[model samples]
Target: MHSDKAIITCAITGVLTDPGQHPVPVTPEELAREARRACDAGASVVHLHFRRQEPGKGHLPSWDPQLARDCVQALRAACPGLIINQSTGVVGPDCQGPIDCLRATRPEMAACNAGSLNYLKVRSDGAWAWPPTLFDNPPAKVKEFIDAMAETGTLPEFECFDLGIVRCVQMYRQTGMYQGLPEYNFVFGVASGMPADPDLLPILLRLKIPQAPWQATL
Candidate 1:
C-alpha cells in the first residue's frame, strides 16, 4: 500500500467561477470560514485560489501577494495544522504571479501543471462555452514553478490532465528539472482533457512512478 490513509483536499474557490452564482468564497475571512467547515467535514488540506476582493469583482482571479498571504494566514488560524495547497495554474509564460504567491504563502503544497492543454468547453448547440485558449505550460515555465516550490520547501503536486502529461512528469524527474518522487494529481472532467472514468485509474496507476503519492481531482 502507498500509505495508511488518504488526505482529503477541498478547493475553496476556482478561478473565473462567479461567486454570485456559486457558493465560492472570496474574502480571506470567508475562505477561512469555509476552510474550517471543510476541515470539520474531513478535509485535511484546502486548495486555495485567491479571488478579487473588490465588490462585484469577486469572480476574477487575483495574484496579489498580500491577498494570498492574508488568505493563507486566515486558513492557518482557523484550522490549525491544516495543509495548504496553493493553485499555480496560470496561462502563458509570465508566471511571476504564482511564483510570488508561492513565496508569500509558503504553502505545504502547490499545483504544478504537468503540460499544456486546449482549455475548452462546448455548449449543447455546438457553440463554444468560452473562447478557446491554451493553458500553456512549456518546459521552461514548468521549471520556473518547480524552482519556486523548491525554494519555499513546497511540494509540487503535478496536475496531469492526460496520460501523456503524466509521463512527462517522469521525464521532468529524469531530466533533473525536479527532484524526488513526484506527487500526481490526475485531473478529470475537463471537456478537452481526460474524462472522469473509473476504468482509466488502473492504467494511470500502472504508468505512475512506484511509491509516488497521488490523488484524483474531478
Candidate 2:
C-alpha cells in the first residue's frame, strides 16, 4: 500500500562527539530545545544518547538512570507526542547501566544492537583514527536487552550493522524472541560495516523479514 505520510526520527545528540567542538546538546535544557526544534520541523520521533552533564565531560556517554530520566522528562515536556527512541548501545556484556536506564525512563522505543562489529576507523595518512574496539552484542546480551525492553513496555528497534545481523534479526522473529513485526534499522557508513550506498537497499529488503517496517541509518 502507498501513502503520502512518512515518520521522521531526529537524532539530536550522537554519542562521543565533543560538545566543545560540536553543537551537541549535553544538558536537559539543551536537549529539550533541540527536541522542540526537531518536532517543529516535522519529526515525530527523537533518538537520544545521554551524555555526561559534568563540566568538561560532555563528550563522554553516561548511562546514569537519573540522568536518563531527567533527559526523557525534559524532551517529553518540550515536544508533546514525540516518540522517544533511546540509545542502548554499550561496549560489552555488562549492560546493567542500560537496563537501569530502560527501567528508569520507560521510553517508547529503544535500540537493540543485533550483532557485534569491529568498531574501527582509519585516518587519511594510513593511521588509526582511534584504537580498534569491539562493539560486542552477543546472543545472550541481545536477549537480555530485549527482555528488559519487554518489561518496560518499550519496543526494540533492532540495529543491523551488517547483512548477517539483519538475518539474525529475522531469526529473532522466527524464534519468538521478539513478538510482532520486527523493526529493522539498517546501519551503514561504518568503515568495518556496510557502506552507505542506496544500491544495497534492494538486497536488504529482499533479506529482511517480510512486511516488516525498516529504516536506514547512515
Candidate 3:
C-alpha cells in the first residue's frame, strides 16, 4: 500500500467555459475567490486557465499576459504561498501568449503537452462533434515551450494523452530537448484516447521509463 499522502490540486476553472451560462469564474476577482476556496479545502496547487473578460466572448480563451499576471497575483494574495500551475495549451502555431504568461507570472509549474492528439468528441447519434482537430504539438513547438519554461525555472508537467506520446517523453529526454527529470500526466477518458479505468493504470505504469515520476488525472 502507498504510505505517502497524495497532493491535492484543484482545477478552479477551464478554458472556454461560458461565464453566463455556466458557474465557471471569469474575472480576476472571481478566479482569486475560487483559488482561496480551493486552498482552504486543502488544495496545494491550483490549475489555472484564463478566460476572455469581455461579455458574450466567454467561448474564447485569453492570451493576454497582463490578464494572466493579474489573475496569478490575485490568487497569491488571496491564498498566500499557493502553488500555481499555468495552462499553456494553444491550438494554433503561435505560442507567444502562453510563453508571455509564463514570463509574467513565473508560476511554479506549467503544463507542456508532450504530444498532439485529435481533440475530438461525438454526438448522441454517433456523429462527429465539431469535426476532428489535430491539437498539434510538434517537436519544434515542444522544444520552444520547454526552453521558455526552463528560462523561468518552472517545472513542465508533461501531459501524455496516449501510449505513443508517453513514450515520446523518453525520446525528448534522450535528445536533450528537455532537461532534468520528467514529470508525466496520464490523461485518460476521452472519446479518442485511453479510457478511465484503474485496471489500465498498471499497464500504463509499466510503459514509463525508469527515473521518471508520473501522475494520473481523469
Q: Report backbone clashes per prediction.
A: 0, 0, 0
Per-residue alpha-carbon lDDT of candidate 1 for residues 1-218, written as tens digits (9 for 90 to 100):
57678779998796688989998899999999999999999999999999989889998878999999999999999999999999998887899998998999999999999999999999999999999999998989999999999999999999999999999999999999988899999999899999999999999999999999899999
lDDT of 3 by residue, 1-218 (tens): 97988888787776466777788887899999999888888999998998888878766778899999999989999999898988999987899999999999999999999998998889999889778989899999998889999999889999888888988998999999987788988988877888887888887788877768888877
164 Cα displacement, candidate 1 (Å): 0.5
Q: Give the TM-score of candidate 3.
A: 0.95
lDDT by residue for model 2 over 151-185, one digit each (tens)?
Answer: 99999999998999999997887888888998999
Check candidate 2 and list the clashing pairs. none
Cα deviation at 8, candidate 2, in Å, is: 1.2
Q: Would you list the C-alpha lDDT of every candidate in the order shown? A: 0.93, 0.93, 0.87
Runs of candidate 1 with Cα error greater than 4 angstroms are: 1-3
**Can you give the TM-score per candidate against the true fold?**
0.97, 0.97, 0.95
Model 1 lDDT-worst window of ten = 1-10
For candidate 1, what's the RMSD? 1.5
